[model samples]
Target: MRSPLLGVWERLRQGSTSFLVDASLGALLAGWAVVDTLAEPALAPAACLPAAVASGSVALRTRAPMAMAVLASVGFLGYGLAPGTSTPLWSFVTILVVAFAVGAQLRGRRRWAAMSVLLLVTYAVQILDAHRSPGELTWGEVFLTPAVLVLGPALAGWLLQRARRQAVDLRRLAAELETERGRYAAAAAEAERSRIARELHDVISHSVSVMVVQAGAAEQLLPPGSPAREQIRAVRNTGKEALAELRRQLGLLGTGGDPAPLPGLDDLPQLARATGATLTSEGVPAGDTSPGLGLTAYRVVQEALTNASRYAAGASVRIRVVHRGDELELDVANDAGRPADQRGSGRGLAGMRERVELYGGSLDAGPREGGWRVHAWLPRRSGSPR
Candidate 1:
């Protein structure tokens, strides 16, 4: 449970403009005097002076607690020895409040020194009063009374300072933790983007170079105006176009760059023909697809075709696409070919899976019926294909 002094310290921390807190303490001291005067009319005059001194100075407790404590302590001690009167209880309470404030507000050796002086004065008063009335009160009562009054508030103030320090430390640590978390997330995202960029470069540069070299060689051998010669020229032109597109896409990473058009399901036919794979489709719509879904679908096909060229070259491959109203599905299967250590670094399939799953899609790839099959599904937006 929280201590009462800690609760008071929290109120002081608020630093309110209105002096309600100080006024309340002053009111409490006056109230005690009024009650005591009603109970003992003969002692009223003697209590009034000390009461005024203690209560009137309470307004400066937070700003000048040490000074207030000294003033209040002296007034309390003087009232106790006043003729025809005992110590005013309210005056003693006010002194404790100031002592607690001193311990709480002051820092380092100053706090300890101030509290030490206050306690010493309190004991001196008790000793002098006891010496005046020898044998009336024992040394134990003299020790215990000052000890309780002096030590209680000081201990409470020390506890309050410690608790406030701990709370500040916890808040600072929490802010640091949040900052680290955001930095880590941004770092991870940048790393992933770089990885994807590298993979695209590898696939495009290798495939397009091969196509260009093969088409040029065929054109050199074929006769002019031949149908096959025209097809060879088309192949060379297509490879150049694809390479230029890939370069434009890479440029998008720079400042003030225009985004390159991403190939989608509509481009699958050309992609499959270029990769020597047969293409088939069902329920595929014809207008613009969402950029995210289209890019994901394009990457899925690209990765699968690149894998086939590596693991199953010269093999017959078939690619199937099915467009549902809310999602798109793709499958690429190829018959086994010359198996020349086609087991990849596994990054290709991992990248493809990452792309598909990013859009709440699923992917599956494994050997099936003496061939390999890659399948994926991606969520689709409600729009016509481009």
Candidate 2:
């Protein structure tokens, strides 16, 4: 029951037009007051004018509610004690409406003070008016009049204002709850990513260390220039490279950034040779480049060559880097080789694409001319913000 009443009150608070509700209310009360004046043979139509002024000013209740309430109360009492006029029911009703408006619209200490003054002033006026006519006066009627006129509507309006404040607080709390939920979810995802990075670092580092040790033992046991010693040397070199990569990954997981300087174009030849690929370049300089761009370029070549080594082992691979004015381009192509039974996690290619796209670049990787190709174009400009 309480909820339904609150909903109704909320609907009424929503505006229709400029004072449409207030103006309609004022007009109705004025008409009723005029009717009451006409019914009283002693009261003239001129008496209706003051009542209309008092009631109609309620249209400005939201703008000046205290003034409206005071005007209505004064007009109702003053005219009630006029030379030959009687108080009308509509006049008292207008007083009630204006009193409620004062409580609902006025904020802070001013509202309570205005309400108290209205009650006190109305009480004094009623008593003075009754004292002028000796036989018609009663204590109960005087007290009841002020209580009914001031307390009822004012309390109702104050209660409504409190409810409106509570509704606003509830909405703010809900928004805060949603924000907290999103923050918690993000934190959880980051923690999980770090956990996976740590696990990979531990497992891969231990495995690579064991393989390097075994390869070194084999190379030492074999006679110099033996065919098997060369293979063992290659295995040891690959294990060392894998260990370096594992350290880099560990640094990223622990510190959230690369602690060591990233490999750039200079390392491309070694990267290509490790994967048995031929490295070539055109128009690119051997000097310094942007850290972000260089890191992205290195990763692109690394991921492509890694993919070729895993999925197309013993294949003929080619890597090319080109430096066009305002752009850097990369291409890695590999002919089909012995098919591997296992596939990758797909994260390496995705990470490469993400890195390229971060610099407003483009990447394309797919089958082309009986071989797999990965191509990327990254932007470069002097004085560009990193």
Candidate 3:
């Protein structure tokens, strides 16, 4: 439940272009009108009636600028030349604010033309008001007063408009850059998948093919019905199947798929064994994890394990994964290697961070507790905030 004042504030926030500032200016002028009226001999507020009305035009300055300017200026001539009580202070302020609003609202040649008409009318009001009661006003006051009354506020409004346009242009440029960055990240992930496909073709596939050939040669060297010959035959058959699987994967990877759902969390234990790291998990894994997020998490852990293997060789490395309902947390820490030594070049870590962040998660790799640690908090669903 919102308080009445809060609801009013929310309405104001959703109001016109310069609603708060104009409203504040209007309020200040209205208060000054009250003060000026109380200073009269009869202490009558009615003397400030026209000023109060003009102040309202100032409040809705940008809502209908040209119309309000016309009304505030042309409508003000009668009060300006009136010979009785002095015009209320708010009316003068309203003219100035309205002039400023009109200057800021219109653009290009049209602004100058509209401002010209507004300036002439307001200046006439200023001059008439001055001539009617010059009370202790100097010669300089008469000459410079119209300029202050019209030119100053209009110039300030023009400056403000220029600044606002520059700010808008800068914001647009920043948004474009952000969108470009996202495209680059996506391209990088695609490139990595294609590269993996190439490695499997050039390295693993060729090795498996050669092993199959070599196993056939070895089986021929062995005597018929020998126990070792059967084993060699099984090895050759397995290598052929692996080569076929690699070709199948290449079809997917070569076509711009993202990471190809390679080696997700379920495969991390074998990865831990290969890299000589202890693995631990907590909480039940969510069944609905997106392929993109699962693949990103796998790549992050793989990079960490590889770094630990290369830099911390004989150091104790531990990999921990925790399922927190909507997100997953992975921590790879080595107890012996220095953070600086473990994070050298940072190319691999940077790629991992980009992939993780593309899915709207965070990656932090640094030294911790006399060791180095790579920490990643990833959402279970792709692109969901963690």
Candidate 4:
């Protein structure tokens, strides 16, 4: 639907002040032609004088388009007084250009009124001068010429306004796209950070729980001269194991290497043994659980054991891992015999709940029958959990 020539013309119009320049040059050419072809010697100077003035008025088209229009109208009337002059016809082109510019640049009702007056005056003067018969100034000709002049500019201005509105809409769409992209990036970053926090908590809490259990056992069993040497050795071995696990977990955060091995369901028994908590496993085989689910299961148990050892040290703990049908379930319970001073501020329980919820699972932690219990169920996929 687009023409290359029209595009080129519009580009030229935009790039230079040539519309008025071309109009002025055209007026001068028409005047010269009229002087040579239509004007007699006596009227030639007068016939060409209005054309010269109309040509010069083009310079003020943008600055004072209404004034230029009035000047061109006057030129047309002056040229009409000269005998055998046809140069006044060309002045109408200048008057049209000035009216269009005025309508396009000025705002509101005033601009339309000014354009209407200009067109009406130009049409009246041309009709009165050009017609010879008494009935030559018909209503049809009077209305038609001015309508053509006014509507041409009004149509151009309308198209220009539409194009401007489209450009503004495009800019707003681009800004909204940028804003949405930024929000997506921020959400992605927050998700990654939460994953890392969960991983760190699992690794450190598991190691610390093992250390606490071994240290407590060593303290209780090491009495003078009653087979205390083996208990001392076991404590030393447990301490070394805890330290080694801590180092391995920290090394996974290295920048230039593959990630360290992550603990999964296979490591749950060892985890339970280290914490001195009784562990029971049931339902589907360990191989059936996905890597992510296994990792989450191990961490939940690890957090549970750490909480038990810290706040309920001497209490017996029971830990269970069950894969029932399509879901994995975990439960840890320990007698809450600690004095009020030894209880936690509930941050660990809240953290556990948050971690479970991230994988589309649900967790419950509270006191149960003179003991503390933490239970969680994680789904095989995101949509449903048990």
Candidate 5:
């Protein structure tokens, strides 16, 4: 998608680049030999047989090198013995490329051994000017020349193969390094956020504690049943509630101490009594519910009760929990009443929403029937990722 050349390259590689290059070279060289054969009267159409074999056999250098070696063995033998004063350099270059391919691409000694024999037979019997008989063939001509010509190109090909392997290994290492770098960045970001949260918690806790103590002192100076005494008492009570909520939230963030377990269905009765809310349930007993669903149920009701106390004090609050086989449903609602203090950061609703979603559930909080309502649907037995 990023580059048009990437698509072209994929097509070329799939077609086998080595086969294409070798086949093209073979066609050009064979065409030259065919033209030379047509020019010479002595070398008729029959002499072009070896040229045809070499042309096609060169294409299989990588796919099937042994097959090419077998065919080239028969083809070059005929070309060497063909009626001519001498052969051209193209014929020898074709043989050299074949020898190099065998050494570089194949895995076993048998292929190289076969190639060595082919080189010897082709060199010894190849058409030459003032041709010598078999007995006149010297040791230097037999071993030394063939060794130099065959080994030189084969060594080059082998070195190229090694360099290709190193390039592939380096690419793999670079990809792994990129993955590790991303993981480290994520860990550092999370640690920084936690550090800021702890700092904020300390500052806010100290300030709120000081306000509660001063309010208590103010109440002591006032007469019993005075209008100012009640206001001071409310300030002290609100500060206590804020501290409790702060501790609950910090506990959820892995504070590394003996943290109390979150309230659940089993503690709903006590929670209702403390908040002056009524609780009703259906379908399943508290002990039969999964811990994750029960915990979510308790939190939803606790948040709804806190909201009612803030905005609709002395109102009728009701908590309902129902188990419908595969799912658990919760609904908390309050009747319209007097508006009390309107102070909140609104984090309780956000926290309850996120906590429910972490268990793959949903929370719906909004106004209903002139009062606020929070309804949540949670799947039974699903674990919380938090």
Candidate 6:
């Protein structure tokens, strides 16, 4: 309700300002004519009335500028023809005002035509008046008055029109900039939400997989005082480890808490052992790799194993990371005999692709032969070999 009321008020204010600007110009011209004409004693009282009325017509100049101009010209002519009327200087002021208004409103050829007609008519009136009076028409008075009266006003109007057009263009450009800003803001917000969702998914999925695996192992090894007691204790330790990691990760997402250190490529071996997946590292030592490359390597393996355990329950998976020149390459493959419908929806693969691409890297994942494969390559640093 408040917004609607404000909109109405803004519209009203704009309309009022436009009206005042247009009407004020008209009123000024009329007032000038009144002051100039009243100064001459030779002009009759009736002649002064037409000159005064011509000034008021300026109020309608913007709306019906051409018509108001015609009206003012006709009034000036009428005043000139009146008996006892001296040279009507005030009449010229109204004609000039009308000439300027016409040029401002009319465009191109029409504007030139209006200006030409105004000059011709005003000069003709001056010439006829001089012919009837005792004074002879001098070149300066004949040419200068009409030029000043018509061209001066027309030039002013043309400039004002140009200024108004530039202002309108500026407003349109500002609106477009504002719209683009809003769209970018919305896109940023959506991206942040997506990152949070991915983080939550990773934490939850990893915790659940560890819990299920340990529970299954404990159940299978449960017996009466057998050597399997050691295996059961191992299961308890695994469960506790999984729970502690889950709590730490979840706390990072809580209010006013610092984020836990992210599990990077260096943590891949621990991740594999925790998930009960037979894992082997065949590349350079993790400590020798850069932090960025290690992080990417870790996330890829983590997402891959999570998907394999969830979808391909009993499948043996092979994970490999290789440092070749200035590029780090990764490949995770699983030969778990599972149908397409049994596999994860590939969101982890998509997230891996996004993460790799941020570092100007490439990723590929698809069904190959009888199994699925995920591969990625990330540049080591600036100016590193591709």
What is the lDDT of every predicted structure here? Answer: 0.75, 0.77, 0.74, 0.68, 0.74, 0.71
Candidate 6 local lDDT, 103-133, one digit each (tens): 7887787788778777876787777767676
lDDT by residue (1-386, candidate 2, tens digit) is 46988887676667546468777877887777777777888776677777677777677777568777667766666565555654456767777887788778888888887788778766876677577666686888877898788888998989999999999999999999999999999888877677556545544565578789999998999998899998999999999998998878777666475333446667888888777789888995735466556767888998888888788877899998998777889999999988774576779888888888877888999998877999999887631222
Q: Give the Cα error of residue 278 in candidate 6, in Å.
A: 32
Q: Write the per-residue lDDT of candidate 3 for residues 331-375, one digit (tens) a residue.
A: 999976643353466688898899888778889998888678999
Of 1 and 3, which scores higher on TM-score? 1
Greater-TM-score candidate between 3 and 4:
3
For model 4, residues 1-386, the per-residue Cα lDDT tens digits are 99999999888679467666756655665565355534455466656666666555656555566666666666666765666544244555666665666666555675676666667666766576546334755667667776777667755754665677789999999999999999999888766655564555455555466666777677666676666666766776777777666556545544223334578889998998897899888887645555556787787889888888887777899998887677788999999756434667677778778767877888998899989999998876542122
- In model 5, state the lDDT of residue 66: 79
Considering summed lDDT, which 10 consecutive residues are worst modelled in model 2? 253-262
Q: How accurate is candidate 1 locally (lDDT)?
A: 0.75
Residue pairs clashing, model 1: 287-384, 287-385, 287-386, 288-384, 288-385, 288-386
TM-score of each: 0.55, 0.54, 0.54, 0.46, 0.51, 0.52
Stretches of candidate 2 off by over 4 Å are: 1-18, 128-134, 220-237, 247-386
Give the residue spans of candidate 4 off by over 4 A: 1-49, 53-89, 130-137, 191-386
Q: Could you give me the TM-score of model 6 versus the true structure?
A: 0.52
Residue 92 alpha-carbon offset, candidate 1, angstroms: 3.9
Off by over 4 Å in 5: 1-13, 16-20, 38-44, 62-66, 81-87, 107-138, 213-224, 229-386
RMSD of each: 14.3, 18.4, 15.7, 16.6, 20.7, 15.2
State the displacement of the C-alpha of residue 283, model 4, in Å, after optimal TM-score superposition. Answer: 2.4
Candidate 3 residue-wise lDDT at 145 = 70
